[model samples]
Target: MMLSSMTLSRKYVILGIAVAGLIGSLTSAGAQIQYQTGQNVAPVYEGWMHNDDGSIDMVFGYLNRNWEEVLSVPIGPENNVQPGGPDRGQPTIFVPRRFTQPPGERREQCVFRVRVPAGWGPKQEIAWTLTAHGRTDKAVGTLDPLDEIDTHVIAENRAFTITEGNKPPSIQSLKADPDTVTLPGTVTLTARVTDDGLPKPPAPQPGSGNAGGRGNAAAASSAVAALAFMGDASLDCR
Candidate 1:
């Protein structure tokens, strides 16, 4: 009897340890999978703005679920925009999720635009569809009165405030040193950026903690042009 009791106690101890280890392993796996690869990309219809030529530009961006995966989906049945064509200046390469701010929103905004003539019906819709990682998602664009965005809205989304007469910095003489490159080769890009230097930083107050540093607005503008292409392939921007 004594021997049987000892054996039963040992068995219980081993079983408990195994169960605990299994639970711990599951928790570790769940945490590690938070930003795992092979996630899908979702199309985002940012908004629309009226162009000076009486045309409306429907802006779009994408949300790549994996923080570590950069997806290249060529234009085709899997990636397409409709109500005109499968391609309307949409990006073929979907980058990973950038910074996470404003909580729960992780999207690359204003990547591209599709122009609609001025007379386009307000109820008309343009759909941009993308399929990645075996999942398909779409973003629909319409002239929804609530969805109209102006320069101020765009600037706010970009985390910068633009006052009147504050024009966006421009990129001049942007070119890749070797316009053509063979595979496994690198190309250098050069560009000159100009800005009106509007929206100057606020003057340092008596003690607002020594005036937080300000970034170069022109440099930030120049980074927007960093998304370039080589031949027909979309180059990944690091």
Candidate 2:
């Protein structure tokens, strides 16, 4: 009986030690996984703005505590005004710029804008923020913030000048229509415009007029146009 009792005690002791070791191993593994995953586990935000002229603009940047402009690009402007050129009718606006973070820094700020529709009100302004982590491969101590905005309002009204043969007309809105009409008088007709924020089809000439560089700039414009008018189904900007 004495021997049996001693054997039972030893067995219990061995089981206890094994269980403790297993628990310790699991705890260590969890710590390692957490360490491997860098900071900031959040989703980035993106903003989309749509204009009545069948054009769309997209502005994207990071935000920390407040709104920051990271990058802004206007898409359909190039194709409508330029006459077979990428940016002929499009306004010559500054492209959104990016900033580089120095070592040990974990946050950044950026800002951008979209042209308001003809009758947008002050209350139409919309803003939002999001968080994301493990975006960078370097395993920085902190993560970055993603800002997003999607707003709709009346298009802005602007004056356009008509040259000798040019017509004085304006873009009202974009819709699906399949009809054609001929006017009685010899009036100049301005073509209706629609854009999805994608790059306009490549202009016939690369650098002839408003068409910018041949690479990403052209492609990005078209992309933005496509995203804007396509109804926010694919893009989360809205």
- For model 2, residues 42-143, the per-residue Cα lDDT tens digits are 212234455668444434333221123222223443112111333322222221221333333333222333343444443343322222331321111111
Shift of residue 210 alpha carbon in model 2, Å = 71
Let me know the TM-score candidate 2 reaches against the reference structure. 0.21
TM-score of each: 0.69, 0.21
Q: Positional deviation of 17 in candidate 2, in angstroms?
A: 1.4
C-alpha-based local distance difference test score of model 2: 0.33
Local distance difference test, per candidate?
A: 0.80, 0.33
Q: Cα deviation in Å at residue 178, candidate 1?
A: 5.3
lDDT of 1 by residue, 68-102 (tens): 77788988898899988887888887766554333
| Residue pairs of candidate 1 with colliding backbone atoms | none
**Candidate 1 weakest ten by summed lDDT:** 228-237
